[model samples]
Target chain A: MTIVLEKPAPARSGPGAPPPHDDTPARGARALRALGRLSRLTLTRSVVVLALFALWELAPRWELADRTFLPPFTEVAAAWWELALDGRLWENTEASLVRSGLGFGLAVLCAVPLGLLIGWYRPLADLLNPLLELFRNTAALALLPVFILLLGIGETSKVAIVLFACTWPILLNTVSAVRTVDPTLIRLARSMDLSAPRLLQKVVLPAALPTVFTGIRLAGGTAILVLVAAEMVGAKAGLGFLINSSQYNFAIPQMYAGIITISALGLLLNQLLLWAERRLTSWRPQPRG
Target chain B: MTAKINLRAVSKAFPARGGRESVLALDGLELDIGAGEFTVVVGPSGCGKSTLLDLLGGLDRPTSGEILLDGAPVTGPGLDRGIVFQQYALLPWRTAAGNVEFGLEATGTPRRERAALAREHLELVGLGGFEDRHPHELSGGMRQRVAIARSLAYDPGVLLMDEPFAALDAQTRESLQDELLRIWERTGKTIVFITHGIDEAVYLGGRVAVLTSRPGRIKDVVPVELGEARAAHADLRSSPEFALHRRQVWQLLHEEVDRAQELEREAVAR
Candidate 1:
């Protein structure tokens, strides 16, 4: 694609000369050109990924490692198919997704408004800074045992851990985002006689949104991480529990399937958040670099 | 008839950070701008030209004096005065038209009316078709044009501008200066524009007020008598009368620049 696109020789230069506006290429030629460009761009990347999968599939079969411990990619796919046919994988995935959704939703609900207030009001920020810092510094996973102790090894404790893990990124990012809005923008708003609430609604919030969405994306990853870990602790039905039990029972193929499902879920969630961010900030100029 | 804006003994001070003494930005600065007059202020950097505009715009209060709009004491930022900042402070999240409509929105103008006014102002600034473009999408000159449109859309009696063209390229700056003069004449709005450029002051205003170094005070008010030719003649900037006015303003500003440098050196030494 680069080779084809970079070749430049068609010069139509002169003062008052019209730009070359030929758009009369045949349909077949245009389609072939697009296909050639697509293959040039994507073929190498696809080859590399497929080579890794081929290695995974062939390694154990050639007795390069113990098949029982290191199952071939085919075995994992077979296990995934079996689980899907019986609906067990879907059930576990649905359970995990629901828990993640609830926890992340709660975190966003509480954190954004709190962050805005703390950022906007200096006195509140000063009062909360030390406490928030202490909590944020404490590893969220480290608090899992305490959460289990206080709330018990149930859905409550699992959701609480996810909430705890997700809240800080969203809150801290939002606080900084609100605090660092362009001072000139605020001055302009004030010059226009925009009241405090109107200024926040119209200028501060929108300006902070791109940063806030960044925080949300980070929190989305954190939520999934914490959710899986929490599910591993005394959970009966979840992707994390499936992986944990499969390993104990020597079901290596099933374990790999669970791991793949978790990673795929995370990727899907990240993409969704990215789409939301793009929609919300469409007014922003496309990034130059 | 009363002046549109009256600044009587206006002074502004900023409290020092750390253990340093408080700095006086403006000291007993007095000036009067008549209704529909175009007044340009030129001074050394940090001569409180912006501070003067802020006081007149009612965005900042004078420390020990009064600023009056017409007969009323200026209290706070109001809809009657519009300000165009040097940074072209249009909201990045808003399109050109939305930014132009900001003041109208604040004043509770109906949506349809605001849209029409915004479009009209955008057209006036030669940005008619670019109304939907965001600030980041526009060039610096275009963004400043949108800022000018935003300031004008609300129909303010007084327009206060602080070096609105300082960031643009020379060509863009000259063209924008011409556009601003045309707008000022057509709207008949009392304008107090601040700049560090002596030539810009001579080109834009009927009267140029040269300010001293901090604590800044009005050093001289030079009336420009370029007549109608100044506005109508494209070659007026290169004309001898224009040079004379530019040189006169530069001469007053040169002394203040030296004074400002000396003050800066003393502060650094202290």
Candidate 2:
């Protein structure tokens, strides 16, 4: 169980340092070294992934499982290709994405300002705390029937369910973040005689942004989870609906394809949120492990 | 000249938990700081040194009596006073220059002028070429320097520094003290500094006010007779006058510290 780690090349040269030799042999040696490092970094993971795929492809053919219920990797790939060619995969993906985006956006739009207000004003927080706790504790999925009854079985109910599920994390995390801001910083701001609005703008908001982003990232994951569950209950054209329909019709290969598509979409959304978090909090010091 | 600050029978009390009797932090403290003077306050731990600075900075109010600035009563926090906190309370999200520009921005200074003034003050504090760096990127000493720059940039008449260099290394503390002396000389602003270190108080203050234990009040105000060229004299700390002043402050603080410890023990026993 030897672990090989990739280390970047040491940076020895600076502006005042002498230039390195530009001969072909030296350049060729440097290129070879970089190539070796790259392979050491990526080759092991690639081999493991390929081996897994090969095992999946071979298991069905070897009669390890019933082919109708557990089709080979190739069959799933072929079904996915067919769906893509007919535009069903793209349409379904777009539908799921739009629902999650709208629900998540609505949650952020409502929760953030409310959270800031609740966090900043103690009276408001005291008034809202018990009610918010009650609603948050009530499982979002259990409200599915109620939402459908009131909002109907169309996109509204599905999006509304997601909005309900996603709002808590963003709201609660923001409130805690604002409340826990360093008191010394607030005193410093006060010493400057900053007006109430200016204090919120210059100190409170920026101080709490990193924690607020954490809430948003959590909400993103919740939105996807709730969206998929809601779509399964009643929807025509999302990854969740695709999986449900395929399972009912005994199209195991299509069901696997739908599951993989949802996983891929979740991964992409998380990465995008992480990128935004990094850009916005560039001034924050990196935590030392 | 009229005093820059006049504290008349100032007292502060905090409500204790569980409906207990209030704890007195400061008690009928009367003092006056002349304009353009450097006044250092030294006291035992838990002597409400910070509470005193908070009142003077207008971050907190005295429960009784009045604190007058120039001829007017101190109300709330205002642009007239600038504070440098011990924790270097620079906003982590802002760059060095941005932190210095904070008070100016609050006072509604134009963006262009704020930048120019921030740059000037940062240079004054010897933080030139480090304007874009964030507080976390800089060392503790550098962060304090930036905080000083921030306080100065606001152009306040009085600078209230609450043990600004207490967290720095000994060498860093010495250099910063010298830097502060130079700045005070150049700016001629009234400075009220709080410190636990007697040496630091003696080195920096033209007048050192020694405070008593809990329910703090001024015990003695010792004048530092070290010459005007003390900042340039590297050996000032080792000079006889400096040591004498340090000992005087230590003697006053020693009794107060013992009293505070005894009070704590009795409280715990109870």
lDDT of 2 by residue, A1-289 (tens): 1234334444448978754554645665666777777677688758998897788888889998788887899999999999889999999999999999999999999998889889999999999999889988998999999999999999999889888888999999989999999999999988888877887878998999999999999999888888888889999989999999999998899999998888888888898998898889989876631
Give the candidate number with the greatest lDDT: 2
Could you give candidate 1's per-residue lDDT for residues B61-151 as a string of tens digits?
A: 8899899898899999998999999999989888999999888998899999999999999999999899889888899999999999998
Backbone clashes per model, in order? 0, 0
Q: How big is the positional error of residue A161 in model 2, measured in Å on the Cα after superposition?
A: 0.9
- Which portions of model 1 show Cα errors greater than 4 Å? A1-23, A26-30, B231-233
Winning candidate number (DockQ): 2
Give, for candidate 2 chain A, the lowest lDDT window spanning 10 residues: A1-10
Stretches of candidate 2 exceeding 4 Å from the true structure: A1-39, A43-52, A287-289, B228-233
